[model samples]
Target: MTGTPEQVDYQQLAAEIMERCEVLGRISADPDHLVRVHLTAEHKIAANQVEEWMKRAGLQTWTDAAGNVCGRNEFGRGSAPALLLGSHIDTVPDAGKYDGPLGVLLAIAVAELINNSGSGLDVPLELVAFSDEEGTRFGNGLSGSYALAGAFEPAWWDYTDADGITFRQAAIDYGLDPDKVNEAARRADELVGYLEAHIEQGPLLEDADLALGVVSSIATGTRHTVTITGQAGHAGGTPYDRRHDALVGASELVVGIEQICSTGGTIGTVGRLQVYPGGVNVIPGRVEFSLDLRAETSPQREAALAEIEAAAAEIAGHRGLGWEIEQFYTSHETACAPWLQGAIAAGIRATGQSEAPMIWSRAGHDGMAIDKITDIAMLFIRCAGGISHAPQESVTVEDVALALEAYEEAVRRSAAAAVAR
Candidate 1:
């Protein structure tokens, strides 16, 4: 258990990390596909497994009030502020294994390597396997990290899953007290910073032919549910000109959203849609759809949303439909800490990259919530085809090996910077 960073076996570490990801992948609600959700039996099993790994890695491990699996390596520095590392353990429906769990495993791997090296940092290290990030079950993502950042909203307790299970009841079922979730919050003064190593989840790193990259910022994202109401009648009885079909009106708005968002350089998606009186012969009376909008800045995102709203209003008026939009979630653009970005760059450089590529994340992450408590940065590993959240998502062992090296070095650099400060 004594070796320098150079002596560390990254290939072995990467292989083990991947194997562990596969192990976690099998603990899913669906046997045919990976489908782990927060506060479910599958989630509990994964958390327990993660805690076991953390303990074996020489970390004092426990499950937080929010159900986050956490481990701390004080390095004998009693009560010192810690450098936190982790990512979510939850997954989307039919998800790929690595999207969330890879980051957690990598953090644990780094902690093990550091512990085995017999060299400790000035700042203590803590690893968290966040209970929920995808919000696959409740539709309110980042709940675990939000609790840790002291941003947990009581209103969320009322949120229900597809099966009508309230988040509060789910927490109780998961053995967490709904009223004491606040205990998960960590004081800002008690944390040096947060670092997460995640797959690029986009083609940027792979396109650039790089093994790793440093995230500059996470995109501003907002989600809304739009509903349109109109007359429902027999499809054959509804004349094209006289019909006030809600589905047709919503279709116009969806197209408008795509056009406006595209022109404004924003990303927009209408991922969910429901039509009432769903009979093939019926002219839909009501339509509900979800809009997920994202951009590099708030102004850009807002501009696109404004344009979309106008379009929806116009479409509703012209089609004689009633329309309403309710914004459900928003995560503003979060810039990585400059100092931490430098440390991440240094870490990438340590992996034989003369220059570390910088990129922006369009996907939301646990860091968005953690940023409320402390500065945060991310290291991105290249993933094949820039695909994620699906079975097609893939990453190479070589890139993971590089990511492990780079992430560990980033932690070391961050620790050095903390000491200097």
Candidate 2:
């Protein structure tokens, strides 16, 4: 991005990126070699593997209060603003190889390239392999980044996993100081920029025949639980109109909620549901369900939730039943910076693409939280069939190389800009 002639060796750099991926895949390959690193017992093994890998990469590593691992390529004592590149290594219960590991590996690969080059570019670079970014533990996404941004909730500490392990204990066991968790948050100005490389998590890039797609915006989402209460009676004893059937109420509201979200061109789902004392011969006494609503923007998503809430209220009131709703989580959209997008556009053209559209991320990512609070952006490489979070999640060696080029170029541009100013 800055230097002239042949300061960077693209071939060797690509090989290094691939090589790191290979080692990472090898060390963590457990059942079917899916490379899953959940926040459970396997987490200790996973973090140890990652830290050891960083050490092998000739980089200095440290863990923050939130369990985020930071590695630095320190060049000089001038305190040059850094180019922060990272993604989470933790995955769901089962996962593909490329989701979070690729970005972390590629960041180290980029650093290797810069270190090997005999150039004057000495801009400091930092690569992070964030802990708890997947939110697999305690159902909280972006745990590390949220803590780093000072947006972590105190209640998160009180959260006990299914096995009854508190967050504080987990931190302590993971070799972090539980008392200093809050000190890990960024002080509002320590970082210069951040970048994340991730799979598209969809089939769009592959369907459209593209090398890599740059992210434009992330969607805001709201998760709410709805409960309905009604009188329960024997099915044969109660007439249809006389029975205050909670199951029927819930089912009707489910359809109405579906129609409301769909008709408004918003995405929604009844992701979870349960009927109290579920039985075939009994009228339902209580029903509990969850609604997941998402939109390209916050206001739109909130509006759809309002429609769903109103629908639920009407359904409960019509049946002379009781109802209540509780919000689970709310995350807003994060917009990519214009110049950064343009810079990545230049990187895309460097790979001989005619155009690359700014695609939106439908699923929740650590990028969503970081981008909203920090100067962060992401790159989406095509996944096989756009599949993610499954055992079949795969990316090509060729595409990995292509993404490496774009990632390095983008990082170089940003780091060079840091040095320039």
Candidate 3:
């Protein structure tokens, strides 16, 4: 009993999405700023709001043990395998309103629209608003999705926040039973696949004059903390050829990293740096910095990292300095499921666009963690100028409308594919 595409009130849905984003934006821990981290009062508030909305959408909603808000529309087939849709809900400090919330709200809006249209999906549908994807509090991103994927690490229970709150204690304070956290893990047989609709968070679609694109893959990379150590000496006494200047060595390594990444397929960034013995007349004796290296594939990223490491060692040796690099984080690239990609492409074509663009997401996403367990696919909605993670991050109502249309179609197509299989 599904209705025609024109029967969908996309304009009203867009307005509602905007209104809800504003509402959640107001539910931040910082009354004067937008910072809602995991297991905090603001996180619980936002999850409650989303739970109410899910219930209103004719869904059986609940907050998972990991604090993720979830809803499911079984459509008469109880406990059936479902197509999962969602994105994370937590935000970084002083973050924009839409990054994570947009996808979750869009999924709920699609559900409400279908319910109102007197139509039903051929397959079960489940929506999740993941609780902690930004990892602002614990330095461990994708906690919600990782738990859902049955990948939660026990060591994380002891992880502490900036306020010295342990992850387990924070969960308890948020009114969740930390002992039952393992119950949040979903078995592999529980889902058909996962689909997430998120902002492009980049300039590719806008530059191409398009409103949406299907993601081909998520980026893979390595992260490290690098330290270069040398001898400190008076600035006047340190000779150009005889002195071991750690800051100079670090500066050279930064330039070398840029050169390595500039070869065109990788991205390298030195986001943080610190120098020891800060003084006007003292040469820096020790320097520490951060490196975020990324590429579309593991091999490519590893190659770039190897080149950077070799260069670092060579430069440190030439400068007569001691150097060490401690690798902290690494994630392999995740490619979208082929059939899911086909479904997304079909959905894009339904919007009067003969050519649906494909792009790789340079930014990390929950899909990174979820992909470890289930097939994951993502739709990228165009933003104004490809900016994200900042207050200026924005998307138009029209763009959201298009995103909704494509998202719904993709869901329907995925349902059909599931039935066929």
Candidate 4:
């Protein structure tokens, strides 16, 4: 049963990982689409399934108080500081199969290979399938990782889902004691570092014709809700000069957000919008919308946000409307630790690349939260057309096979680095 990197059947392993992702894909809240939110019935089912996979990988498994599915392979080295590998299992509505599940499945595959190899590592391996990362239910993402990092916010307990169920109530329904969530926190000195493998979710890798790349950093992101209020009146009765249309003001601000952010070299998205008084003859008196802003650094993002705020004020004043903006969530930019980056680079080289390609992630990840407790690094697998967060997301079996090889090598190199330290 002895195995090695070369001895591993990567094609078979890749197939299994993909198939597992599909299996998870089917365990969603929406029957017609993939939508597994945190602390829901579907989440409980997926966590149990992941726990089973972890057991098969020769790891001691448990679900943390925060509902994170966690497993550890001590390799007979009890009390040893472990190397953590993981990704979130919770996904956005109608999410792609590979976005979060692929990383967890790949980590399991690596653990299985390492266990069968009988080449015990200097450090133990820990795998986590985080319960919540998408914030699809609560609008505050990375709750699982934040809990593990000991950064869980007390205010999140009051956050409610669309069904008006508070997070605390949801936790209780999920068989978790909301007051005991802090028990899931892991100390900084208890582990080595964290690593995650994810689809590139962009066109860079596919465009460069590379199977994988190392992430240099993750972008800082901020999300806000903006509301504009005005007087509702009959659309045909209200004169254009007398009208203070909230929707028009909101629209102007949205366009201003795009213009300012684009010119400032930051990214801005108005993903959701709602208008009150829904009627063909009725003018929208109130408008609410979401703004997701991101940039490589805080200063860049702040400057863009400031401009957006000024524009909002101006539009509100000109339209004689009242406007308010409230920030809901934010994650700071995080750099991949140099040493861990080197380990990932070495792993990429093991996959036959003379040089490892480095890219910065514009998307958010659990690593942004985990970075508060430990160093973090990520390996990106190229997806077809760089599409993700949708059913169209895809990755070739050949690419996943190479990713498995790279990810396993990364773990080995990380273990070696830990020993040397």
Candidate 4 residue-wise lDDT at 281: 89
Please estimate how well model 2 matches the true structure, expressed as its whole-model Cα lDDT.
Answer: 0.75
Off by over 4 Å in 1: 1-3
Pitting candidate 3 against candidate 4, the one with the higher lDDT is 4
After aligning candidate 1 to the native by TM-score, how far in Å is the CA of 268 from where it should be?
0.6
lDDT of 2 by residue, 6-33 (tens): 6555555556666666555554436565
Ranking by lDDT: 1, 4, 3, 2
Q: In every candidate, how many clashes are there?
A: 1, 1, 1, 0
Q: Show where candidate 4 strays beyond 4 Å.
A: none
In model 2, which runs have C-alpha deviations exceeding 4 angstroms?
1-39, 120-122, 317-320, 419-421
What is the C-alpha lDDT profile of model 3 across 194-255, one tens digit per residue?
A: 99999989999999999989999999978999999998899998688879999999999999
TM-score of 1: 0.96
lDDT at residue 24 of model 1 (Cα atoms): 97
What candidate 3 gets wrong by more than 4 Å, as runs, is 1-4
Against the hidden true structure, what lDDT does model 3 obtain? 0.89
RMSD of each: 1.6, 3.3, 1.8, 1.8
Supply candidate 2's per-residue lDDT for 236: 99
On a 0 to 100 scale, what is the lDDT of residue 212 in model 1? 92
Candidate 4 residue-wise lDDT at 328: 79
